[model samples]
Target: MPNYIALDWEQDQLFGIEADVNSGAVRLKRAFNLKWPDDVGTDPSARGQWLGTQLQEHRISASQALVTLPREDAVVRHLELPPCPADELSELVRFQAAIKSTRPIDELLLDYLPVEIADDEVAQSVLMTTVAREQSDSIRQTLESAGLTLASIGLTPVAAAELVVRVEEQQRLDETETSLVVWAHGDRVEISVIKRRSLLFTHSTRLTSTEDTSQHIQTILAEVSRSFVALQKLLPDVSIARGWIIAPNEEAETLAARLQERLSISTVSIPEISVRTIDPLNLSGSATVPIDVPGSHAPYVGPAGILMWASGGRAEFVDFLNPRRPAEVKDTRKLRAIVIAASVAVIIGGGLFWRQSEVAALEKAYLDAKSEQSSLEELQERAAGNVENVTAVQEWVDNRVDWLAKSHDLFNDMNGTERYYLTDLRMTLAGGSGAGNITGNGESKTYGEVITLYQDLGEHPERVVNTHEIPRGKDAEYPFRFELDINLQKPEPIEEPARDDAEDTKTETEEE
Candidate 1:
């Protein structure tokens, strides 16, 4: 079951029903009739608050609502046009309405019933309905203030027509002929004509309030006659085989009896509510409201009619909120913008993917370089050990004394001797630094020659020490034997003396 709230906004009163349709029948769950507060007058806020309080007490929980605008609130037009394209019908109606309306067309909200056979079922006429945008917004705001959302909006006359047609279908009436429906509630009467389930004509007439039921009946009869004459002018050969009356059973029976006695309509009776079930005990929203205050079940016609429109009778009703419009135009600029946006998104996505791949490749390269660096570090450790060994050998070679030069100098000293010979000669490190000693033993023919050689070796900065000297046999070729230890020092680095250019020139002049 689908739930919806049906609201009928009448002058000084708000009639509502919370219902659900089961199978094809509308079951009234809760109903309310809130009168405008006498203290608040016409203040919308106070009215909304009072209505909300009443609803809360009644427990009307359906949030979405269908509203019925009183017939006077909308402008209705019936036009018979030359057959045109279905799509162009809307534009044609709009242009015609604009020409007729005193106000700008943009200020009005419009809805229409499409072309349908006239009351005669031969000619066709269109019903175009419009309401002021300000009126529609006011209704919307009023409902919103009462904690209700506006789902659809429609005129009371069209809704009443829909109700009567739907009730006719339920009663298994002959649908082949045109039907006329009369709905009287509050201070107005709604008269609608139908053919083949399509609404042909509907009119709302205000009545003066009177205590006499006969007077109401007489006034209704007069209006019914006038409506028929007017309908005849629109559809010359109109055929209305049956008629329906929706009102309280007493008033309905009286009016139907009177109509049957006077009019040519074959059958005129009250449309049955078997498809719509309402409990009188459940109708009142507030506990304080008396069950008998509503008097009869007839006043719920507006809500019930709109409910029918919301359910399945949509094609018969004109909804001002959601109306038939002209052919929709497509914007080429919007299409181009969409295409451009899609292209930009694709480019950005591709760029991001490329950047991600590039970053991944660079990271892999960095890891590979790190691995290669580890291997190079191991090779460097081996090379460093080899370099230290080579450096140690180079230091040894550099620090070693010049043994060949020492031996040649010693031999030159010996050549000065009468007889000279060396038994042993060795170079040993005298200190831990780059200095060593040359040790040798030699024999000379005379002691004087040996002494002279020692004196020659004992030059300043070069040390010569005589360890032992002995006389040899007289027959020996050398008479003296000597042991000598000589200390050889590493050469000191000498800094070049700066030349005196003036002194040199002076000396050159003196030499010249």
Candidate 2:
């Protein structure tokens, strides 16, 4: 929806639709009213209702459109800059424009475009265009009243340049070549030198002296020649390729003839003065020639140019006439901080849950280990009190058996074993004691006594010996108690089983 509405009215209103024929899309949908003698030097509101009514008839919305200021209100200037980085170029242009303009920087909008790129640097020509802030606000208010959105607002000359460039391109003309465009309106003559569709210079002078056609032509030619000369100095080695005279047929012929005689260049007359078809609702019924310059053709070029610029055509020069305001951008640092804080909170919460899970697992393991250890300790204590438990009784019995075996072997192998005999026997298990008495015949008595002592002792070696001994009948009987002491000796090494015998047997069996 690149379509917009352009309104260019100062004296009498002129309206038209500038649509891109290629896409069948509307570039500008507009309506305007001319000022009457009573409305001269007055605000545009004098015919606002009339213009609004016309727009309503044509189904044109004023809110979503762009308005153009009269050429008199805008100051257009060309500026040059040393080749520099693109990012820095805007600031540099603003700084330079501020210094050059008469108004304060805040009161103006600044816009620019690159003209050329040379070497690794950008040699650029800047367009400096400005409108008073008050005037712009008023225009906005008026348009807004009609429910129109003012996408852009600019001056007439810039719009005119835009139209000329489009016509030039549509005609398949070279843009780099200098061309002279003479836009003759009611009382004003807009003379411009365009090089390669880019406006090199513009000069608008009153045509009050047109009463003498010949002199008028001469005066126009002189101004055009001066404009060309100045442009040539700025752009070396360039010449006018053609001359366009936009006026009534008679005026166009006169201007063309004068250009041929003075400039030695071909001249073209554009008779389709109305760049577009007229809207019947807004026009007066008075039978005026459709192709006349002062009637409908005068505003077409400028308005059409504005339409073309709004439609995204290349009009580098127009940018000087309509500088763009900087747009406000949002801050991203605050957004980043918020995101980081949120991420940290999530991490801390997850860590807490993980630590709680580990603690719970360790606590369960500790309780289980403590229970098992307590049960094992209780069993150990019970086993120490009673020998009925097999594991504990076996441990006690094994210790006693080992001692008895050592003592028996020691006594049997001793040199004087007859002098040693068991006097009194007392046996103790791990937690209780047993005392025993024994009687036997002479030769069997001694062995019987030892056997009895060994049996009652329950395999206990220490208990089979006397704990306390004394003579029972005193010195008359000469009573004596004998005790045995035994020391174990190192056992001889046992011989290993013979391997040669097994091998001989295996050989014999194989032979068989």
lDDT (10s digit) by residue, model 1, range 462-506: 455555556574547776787777877777779999999999999
Clashing pairs in 1: none
lDDT for every model? 0.72, 0.54
Candidate 2 at 461: error in angstroms?
11
Worst 10 residues of 2 by lDDT: 279-288
**What shift in Å separates residue 3 of candidate 2 from its native position after superposition?**
6.3
lDDT of 1 at 388: 93
Candidate 1 overall lDDT versus native = 0.72
C-alpha displacement of 123 in model 2, angstroms? 5.4
Q: Would you estimate the TM-scores of all the predictions?
A: 0.58, 0.58
The local lDDT score (0 to 100) that residue 66 gets in candidate 2 is 55
